[model samples]
Target: MANELDGRVAVVTGGASGIGRGIVERFAAEGAKVVIADVQDELGEALASQAGPDALFHHTDVGDQEQIGELVATAVERFGALDVMVNNAGISSPLRRGLFTEDLTEFDRVMRVNLLSVMAGTRDAGRYMAEHGGGSIINLSSIGGIQAGGGVPVYRASKAAILHFTKCAAIELAHYDIRVNCIAPGNIPTPILQSSATGEDRERLERFEARIRAQMRDDRPLKRDGTPEDVAEAALYLATERSRYVTGIVLPVEGGTIAGKVMARKAGSEIPANGAPS
Candidate 1:
């Protein structure tokens, strides 16, 4: 897969860390000129430097539609073309005791960052791709959006919105050759969870996160935690021509977490009658 994306240009929002950083690194390794857009200037710049001349960092706040427009334009100006746009910047809502206790404090911020940013990115990038030949746009959603959960309702809602919106955009932009898709990642440890908690709440969040991770491992069919690199691999597929016929699809990179609970059975267990293990 090396150099699969050679001569392409990509803009990855939230390109400094986590899955987004992994995407940037992978894209650059494949010979794409990438613009690393993120508010984390230091980390983004460091990453761009590490990626060599094929990558550049741009300080961007995806929450602002104006900034998103600028990001697209800057990518075009710097790279002379835009072939892929990855709207990966997002924020998680605070974990309240329950939905009832949620004061809806972070609703607007979460919506703007998680949902609105994707919309703006798609619109901005779609416009350019429409006039130009065409391109791929990848949005980052979450398994939380696919399955109903109690905590982080706002975050879930935002991501669900992205899923639907991606489909709509794909239909509309297909005529122009611009492809739109989403990647729903799950059970990947990143700083986003901790960023949503505060002092005492942070400790509670850590405990809650530990319990959830344990449950996820038990429930996951693969029984292994996903890594940023896993999601990055998905992004690479959507970015390159290998997926030329794919669009408006929601790809789940969750190690089969959303499929269903993994049937528990002993190492040498025998199948019982009625096809139910006992």
Candidate 2:
């Protein structure tokens, strides 16, 4: 897909790591001049440097609307136009015992980082795309948002909000020829997971994560873990003209985890009269 995004300009938030980094690299490879927006100066700069002249690193805290505005303007000033906007910066809420023990201390921070940033990115990017002949906006969501589960309730709510917002924005932006969509990634191991933990919690998290991964391997139909590149590929599809007709959709790059759990069966097993495997 070399040069697939020729002459295009893309801005990806949280481009310093994980899925966001993957998208930045992919976009640069496809011939798009990309702006890497993130709070991690060192990592972002290194990634931009590695991407060569087509990429630029910009320090941005998407939680601030003014900074987001600046990021959009920076892309236009440097690259001439903003053709794609990726609202990929997100943080996971800390895992707690249960709803009873939850104090919701990080509620505001999580919403600001995960939900408000996406809204601001879409609105700001849409304003530009609306007048400049339209463009694509890809928002990152998670499988946790799609399915109701325990643990990080706040994060789930924020991602669920993103899913709905993307659809609503798509409908409203359609008149302006701007496209809005979402990519919900599942079971992709990234550093973001570790960032949510501390000393004791970190140890517990590791064990919990291991158990979850083991279960996911059995539950997910594909029997394999997902990668940041998997989500990036989905973003690329939404970013380019290939999906011109597609909008207001939640694309799950979850290895069929949302489809249903894989049914276990023995090799050459036969069903008995009671419908049990023999």
Candidate 2 has what TM-score? 0.94
TM-score of each: 0.94, 0.94
Local distance difference test, candidate 1: 0.93
Off by over 4 Å in 1: 201-205, 266-278
- Clashing pairs for predicted structure model 1, backbone only: none
Q: After superposing candidate 2, which stretches have Cα over 4 Å from the reference?
A: 198-204, 270-278
- Candidate 1 to truth, TM: 0.94
Q: Residues 1-278, candidate 1: write the lDDT tens digits.
A: 58999999999999999999999999998999999999999999999999999899999999999999999999999889999999999999987788788899889999999999999999999999999999999999999889887888899999999999999999999999999999999999998877766454666878967987898889889877899999999999999889999999999999998899887677867876778665
> Candidate 2, clashing residue pairs?
none
